[model samples]
Target: MTDVPSSDIAFTPRVKALQAQRGSRSAYARMEERGGFRTAVTPELAAFLAEVDTAFLATANAKGQPYAQHRGGPAGFIRVVDEHTLGFADFSGNRQYVTTGNLQENERAFLFLIDYAHRRRVKLWGRARVVQDPDLVARLMPEGYEARPEQAILFTVEAWDINCPQHIPRKVDAAAAAAALARLEAERDRLAEENAALRARLGER
Candidate 1:
């Protein structure tokens, strides 16, 4: 067997110079000098987020490694309990418990809600905590629905920012929101037909 040659890779002179220009110390100093940063969510953003049924929940571990999961519920699932408070249900999942585990380590989290049909997006940053009180869950549960076995996670909003839809591409068919469900039905039909054909061939054998 031939031996592979070893190679050394290093930053170019220009890259090294650029890196030195903004070291971690300088970056941290600049951030510290900013005092506090806050952005209010516009009325339009609040309305859009209220209308959407899904959002992407992003959380990070103590080391700042981020994980994102898609969360969905009925329309108006996300509730703006107050001007600075937002809450949503935490349904069951694969049980990886990444978000819940991360929140235990680091309460800071972020959420992004996008209405593809409406061409809008909202970003929310806040501190989150996993709440596990039966009475509280009972109060929050929708009428006629049982409480999920998994506990819910609540997020207390610290700041939120609204992005304009000017940059979002226009949607061609807003009514096609049910296309995915239709595709699933079609796939089920196709599988059934294939199964029936296989059964017929087996009988012929």
Candidate 2:
């Protein structure tokens, strides 16, 4: 049996075999020697997550059927509960309960977070639990957001890694872009007013 590092939780024997066949095993072995992926949230990760407004939660049933669901809120919707834990308020959506049901059967889950504006992405492997406690759900809910909290999802991160921004299409947040345009228009108006005032003063001279 091959010994897998704690941080390399996703690298099973079959995966290692494929990597070896493809000539990538040596590089991954080097990574394992260097402690593999991160098992706890670093300050950089926390900051990155703080600005994440969108994420995808993926889960599988006991029979290995996979499902992915989109989760979005204002920035900082996903809260860093601790070094290895993340919590978020599960907003009342279509009420399908697919994710909740999958979690019950299979705790293993994954989180995919992408910052389209920065062209960065993060992958998280973990176990997830659905919490129906109102106090906990309320604590994770973002203030001033017009979403009803139905429950809370807590993820215990086992391993996490970041990917290079190779093919990610750059995209800015709509709200942020609109605010920038508004500021630019206001500045343009102010400059036009100042220029007109200077011209009037010169005419008076």
Which candidate achieves the best lDDT against the true structure?
2
The residue-level lDDT of candidate 2 at 160 comes to 95
Candidate 1 lDDT by residue in tens digits, 26-143? 5433432553223344576567766787789999999999999898766567766566667666767788999999999999888888876778777777788888876655554545
Q: Count clashing residue pairs per candidate.
A: 0, 0
Candidate 2 per-residue lDDT over residues 1-205, each given as its tens digit = 1256765688888999999999999988888887788889899999999999999999999999999999999999999999999999999999999999999999999999999999999999999999999999989999999999999999999989999999999999999999999999999999999999999999999
Which residue pairs come into collision in candidate 1?
A: none
Score each candidate by Cα lDDT. 0.69, 0.95
Scored by TM-score, the top model is: 2
Error of 2 at 9 (Å): 2.0
Candidate 1 lDDT at 107 equals: 93
Q: Which window of ten consecutive residues has the lowest lDDT sum in model 1?
A: 1-10
Q: For model 2, what is the C-alpha lDDT against the true structure?
A: 0.95
